[model samples]
Target: MDRLSRFARRIFALGAGSSMALVFLVIFVNSVRRYTIGKSIAWGEELPIYLTIYGVMFGIAYAYMTDSHIRFAVFLDMLEEKIKRFVLIACDLLTAATGVTLIFAGHAFAMRRGSVASSGLKSTGDWLAQITGIPWLEWVGKVGTWQYAIVLGGAMLAIAAILRLSERLSAPSKAKEPVAPLAAPAGKAST
Candidate 1:
């Protein structure tokens, strides 16, 4: 399990890094073209927007895997150990539930958009279809942008939540160690 978690983290990091690099390169080239050639790539902005979506989706997973997501630690620190553990477990359960809800909602939204795109593609003239040589209806029918971003983010969050819950459950509880009394200083009378 530990090995699998490590491998997953590495894959997420690589994906996020690649997406970020692609976004940066696309924006840089587009800017150069606009300034030097006086014309920019038509689809340049679109590609970067998609890449940013992918990068942010993967980044969420990476943050969860690294335990870098923000939390109110001060409140947890003030709680008793057992109470803290209970609160953590509850939070993990809530996170998992939210992730599952997002996955379902994202899937539904993607399917609806795909259906709309497919219908629009089917209504286009043959000449346009022949010029593009794209199976637009079929392609749009199969994939949606939401699948790449929201669905992926939700799936990662769910996995992270489950892993956290398991780790918390398996960990051995630690008892507070007794503290020793401070001794009198050398050559000084005891209080």
Candidate 2:
């Protein structure tokens, strides 16, 4: 489990780094192009947008492992113990449900749109026509694109991770702060 989690973290980190680098590089390239050529690459903005979207999609797992995502703690904290547990469980369930919905809905959406080939926001998908001379790699683009697959896989992974977290949350966590006493009744011992 630890190994798997570590691998997931590494994958997420790599995606994030690649996304940021591409975004910055794209901006830099665009500025340079616009300065020198009096215009920018039409594809520059699109590439960065894709990278940003990819990063967000891939960052979910990392967010979970790092606990970096925001949580609304005030209401949760104010709840009594049993209610807190129930609320946590419900939150987990809702997260998992959302993940599952994304998986199915995204897959359906992708299927409907996957047939449309990208012209790269600039050219007429001509890049692939000339690059296939080697023959073996000819059908690469014709093959199903991995981006959609990533969406489906990511949604499943996200849901699975949520369920795993749900199970973990069900068990009492030992790393919690030392158990504190409830307020003492008037006659109770102080200790």
Candidate 3:
């Protein structure tokens, strides 16, 4: 399980990095074309926006896996070990619940916009389908924005939250301290 989680984290990081790169390339090319050629790709703005949305969504999962997200540790740090463990468990439970909500909401949102075809992606999909000769590729070729935003992002977030909760629940508790024997008063030494 640990190995699987690590593998998943790596995959998420790769996806985020790839998306970020794509966005950067698209924006750079669009800028160059507009300035140098006095013309811009009609779909340039939309494509990079979508890629950025996907990148940020996947980045959230990567952050969670790496434990790099922001923490309000001022109060938590002051807690006793046992109490801190309990508090962490409670926080995990809350995060899990939020993930579940996102999953459901994202599904519904995706479904609602599933039939709406994106103008920017539709043409790109058609071109790819022609080159690849894959009929089913066109289906994803014309996906709605919600499919990228809610479906992919929300699903990844939910999965990350669940994995994090499981890790917290199964982690071993901190070892207890060894207590020293109490000494008798200096003037009165008993048997």
Candidate 4:
């Protein structure tokens, strides 16, 4: 079980890291081309867009493992120990349900549209479509559309992590902010 968990974490980190790196590279290349060449690179925009989407989508699993997502820790920190556990369990269950629902929705939507025609992709190019050979990229052919589904799967896994870890955790410390707020004037009501 421990080995499996470690492997999963490694996979999550790799996916997120690759996606972010790709996104950055694409953007950087586009910027260089745009200014140096004095014209937009026709396909440059889509690479970053898709990479960002994939990176963000796949990063959830790792983020959950590290408990990095936004949380209501201010409130959780104030609760009694017993009450905190109850709230954490409730939160975990809610996350799991939410992840499952998203996966279902994504899959259903993908399947319904699978057979429908997709116009040629711009910017990033439908590399997925090209892989199997489709349109003009006869050499590449049509690509698989299963990747987005995988992203949804990762999110569900993240939720699973949350569920598994909830019972074992102490309430997390609140994150500190560098800039303290200035006090409002005594007579004026604060917004």
The whole-model lDDT of each prediction reads 0.74, 0.63, 0.76, 0.62
Highest TM-score, which number? 3
User: Mind sharing the TM-score for model 1?
Assistant: 0.77
In Å, residue 109's CA in model 3 sits off its true spot by: 1.1
1-191: candidate 1 lDDT, tens digit per residue: 66767777887788899999999998999999999999977657566776788788788777777777788989888998889889988988998888888789888878777444332223333335566886552442233742447888788878877777777788887556789999999999996
In terms of lDDT, the poorest run of 10 residues in model 1 is 118-127
Per-residue lDDT over 1-191 for candidate 3, one digit per residue giving the tens place of the 0 to 100 score: 67867987998899899999998898899899999999987668778877888888888888877767778888988888888888877776776667677777877876777667677677766777888999766655455543646667767776777777778778887755889888998999879
Cα deviation of 4 in candidate 2 (Å)?
1.6
Error of 3 at 116 (Å): 2.5
Task: Indicate the worst ten consecutive residues by lDDT in candidate 4.
Answer: 138-147
Report the lDDT tens digits of candidate 4 across residue range 57-124: 76777776656778889998899777877777677677677777777777667666544332323322
User: Candidate 1, clashing residue pairs?
Assistant: none
Displacement of the residue 67 alpha carbon in candidate 3, Å: 2.0
TM-scores, all models, native as reference = 0.77, 0.68, 0.78, 0.64
RMSD of each: 4.7, 5.7, 5.1, 10.7
Q: Give candidate 1 misplaced runs (Cα > 4 Å).
A: 115-143, 182-191
Model 1: per-residue Cα lDDT at residue 103: 89
User: Which pairs clash in model 3?
Assistant: none
- Clash totals in order: 0, 0, 0, 11
